[model samples]
Target: MSQLRLWGHWPLFLFLSGWCAVAIFLDYLYAGIPGRKYFLLLSGLSALLLGLSFPPFGFTPLIFFGFVPLFYIQEIADRNKTSELFYVYNAFVLWNIFDTYWVANAALLPGIVAIWLNSFFMLVPWIGAQWVGRKIPSLRWWSFASFWVVFEWIHHNWEISWPWLTLGNAWSSLTSWIQWYEYTGVFGGTLWTLIMNILFFQFILNLKKQLSIRKNSRTITLILCFLIFPVLISILIDRNFLAEGKYGEICVVQPNYEPHYEKFAVPEMEQITRLGRLAEINLTKDTRFILFPETCIGDIGGPVNSARVQDDNRIITFYDFIESHFNIPIVMGLTTIKFLRDGELDSPFKRTNQAFKEPYEIANSAVILKNRLEKNIPVYNKSRLVPGAEIFPYRRLLPFLSPLVDKLGGTVAGLATQKERTVFEAGNLVIAPVICYESIYGNYMRGYIKNGAQAIFIMTNDGWWDDTPGYKQHMAFSKLRAIEFRKPVIRSANTGISCFIDARGNLGKSLGYNVHSSINQGVTFSPYLSFYAKFGDLLAYLALLFATFFVILRLFRYFF
Candidate 1:
């Protein structure tokens, strides 16, 4: 009887013992550290506040002060002569989990790797700032700001890039306050965020030390000026800004196929026919172009040959439908394979077929097709691929990891990409054909405008992470691009959120998630480029130079 009773209460006993073990471990971890509770509290608070500041939760005002708690945690570490790694890593991991937990809905293993790896990368700048502060305390805050911008800039340019959490992106939805993005781009918002956080942190320190009223008031005044001045300037600019140019009507179709199940499993013609039906419902005689979502072609069948894409049965049907009814151009996304002949230019991304011994490369590409008479078709291969899903970063250095990369949804040799941003001309309209993952790159998009793109058209499939903030956040990020380039944006998604964004970052006629729909809207195209489009990320470049100088100075001091 006694043994039966003890076994019956095993669950309670296990819970009690596990809780005690965690408590003891935490106590040991912070043994010599003072204000242990405060440190832990600030870490959790930092993660919570920052995570809440992102989309789906969207507490935008909280972002201005979110990093204050992290700064406090750093101070505690410095004062106690303790390593801040564990605390900072925990905070970052928690923030990543809270904001991007939806990423696991696509793939379990790759999602975990993305979250953990991104967290580690985020820690680099913080740790570097800490080290620089120890070497030269007077330049501490400057180093922190400059190092962070440099990190974000590197993240945009590198192969292992993931700029989804860039601090400037926090204002993606609040475009009214960031109209200055046309002049400064998203990096300006990042600098604004960092400066505000630093000022608020200094005010907090003054309060802690019971500083004089005059000093506290001065800091408070500076914070208010920094916060209010930007908004006022942005308001004035938005009120005065006008989108001037030729107006053209475009039809965007959202054929809501479930990516994991219906998109690939269904036949190619069936999907094309559905897209045709949606386009027919919304397309008018004045419609200049019809846009389809990414990978709408070549999902059921294998990738079509780039040289003979028009020969595919699905393409024949789509082209016939457009030529018969509308006689207009259609820009759509597809996968294409290109074979290389002997003595041709070579690339490391090439793959060899075991059966025929032929060299070829596969690309996630967007192509614009007109009537059969049009011989030259324009195709732009996506250059910015998702790190694990579409590419294996540093493949030349780590050939041993090719098998692992293959398992993570990438090809063994990685996908091929084009060198230049291609613009497609349909009648009098010239637009940039931006693929799924390319819209988030502000600086990269500038190349299209410089190459004579008047408007931006993005084709994407956001259904992989179904019914999550991933799709919403992706849609929100496009607004930043529209503001930066001062160009109208037309987006077509496979599952939902297809709409038109104006030059001022305003949405017009949006379709919701999981809805099969289409929208016909007239958008104005600007011939003139914005300041940011003309000069790309100047602030980030300056920050990189400053960060490099600081590091060189620190090294000289250490050696001397």
Candidate 2:
């Protein structure tokens, strides 16, 4: 199936493996010492590289998974029992690499490599915990469990954040086990993975010394059950969910028009408008809402403030067209501009951290257009931003990054997000809009449901980097969001894989990553809610607090 078949593939695999080795080595360099002067500096660089893995540059696969064995070797070779702590910490820290970007190959060998490399240090903590279990004797397995989850939570919150590949997501293939995610969230899957890891490690460590077949056989049996029981049960019980199908009809627009090409290009405009028009025309009468990918428009400077610009502006012209022609409400990802000082409409250029000192502000934004009514609409700017491309973390310190900042090519800091999800209504439908890259953050998604969003809308531009796992992982994030909120999610991407996620988190259908493919599919609308929707960030905060205190106490014991 791969074109590589024509090449001497065995050597190709070696070359690919060599590339991975180098990536892992660079990750090591980026993972500076815990208390070093440049620790935060390396961390920032790490996050940028992590975010770059998403789009417009899809290098995440080789670098993230490729060279990870280095960390394992380093941790294992360290003679000091405590020395393993930093290495264990570093592995997850480097794993933050995979969190922010999803390479297209994450489902195949490349993806598996990334997962194993990211998780290699998982064994570090498991071993150290077993050793410390003898030394300090704290609460049993939950200590390591709590440590890992808290570690994951940190990466789950930043610009370079990627939370899609938790060992728990692996259970997506093991449907029966993950069915509980509808109630417990994906962490449940990760927790099970930890338990199995512990069991297997212990079983192997004690294998040769055991004298009798009975004890060893029983341990082996327990290990097998630990690994397989959840998977088997998960597959069987998924049917129960399928039987009580409460599906919705929603459509998503994947305008395969690339953004690097000017959106205002006459031909591009026709194509985008045509796709939106087609979405409007093809909607089933039952379709509750329609979604457009993020910034379906290609050009940056001209249409910055499309939503709330001059009264007779071009932005409004597009809105007026959609409202007048389409009977169904449309939720779209749009880029708009806002004058900073409330001054003249002209672009003012100011210099801040050498980035967007320019007067014209570009924000990655989302707008809701309710059928044929275009006045006084609700809009939300993306709160969290991508580091290199959206908002650089420490631009003030990195003076040389001036050109790099300008390259993100959009508005800096859209709006000071209210830290709350805002909602709008369409013919009894309550639509919540999630901008590109923000869907991966569960806390942000949950706030929308808590505020009353019966259906979720996601707008993204995956073509920035092509059909990498970044796009697939983006879709996976939407699936989890739907499961977490107990509401349907409709995602539209510029390149492909546009899809509708059901309230139950099933993929109804999707568009391919290939060029020029337009997709129309039904999405559901429902008020079905979950524990996570009702109690947003409560569990995450609690986990954070516990890990903080435990780590502090351990630090005191070790050095203070």
Candidate 2's displacement at residue 394, Å, is: 4.8
TM values, all candidates: 0.93, 0.71
Model 1 agreement with the true structure over 461-553: per-residue lDDT tens digits: 887776777888898889999999999999999975899999999989889987998999999877879999999999999998999988987
Worst window of 10 by summed lDDT in candidate 2: 1-10
lDDT score for candidate 2 against the true structure:
0.55
What's the C-alpha lDDT at position 393 in model 2?
45
The digit string of per-residue lDDT tens for model 2 on 1-560 reads 01211111232244336544655565576465443333333433433443344332435322232212322333233323324333333444454343522332211333333344445534544554444444344443445666666656655675444455554444443243455566556666556655554555455545646647676786678767866786576566456643222345666777665444433444545655666665765576666566777865424334455445324244454566555554566677766655456453332222234445545555667777654345667767777665445565454566575564455442333233435677878777677888887887766677777777777788887665444445666676566677666676777787647776776667776777744444556555567667777665454466567656655666566674
C-alpha lDDT score of every prediction, in listed order: 0.83, 0.55
TM-score of 2: 0.71
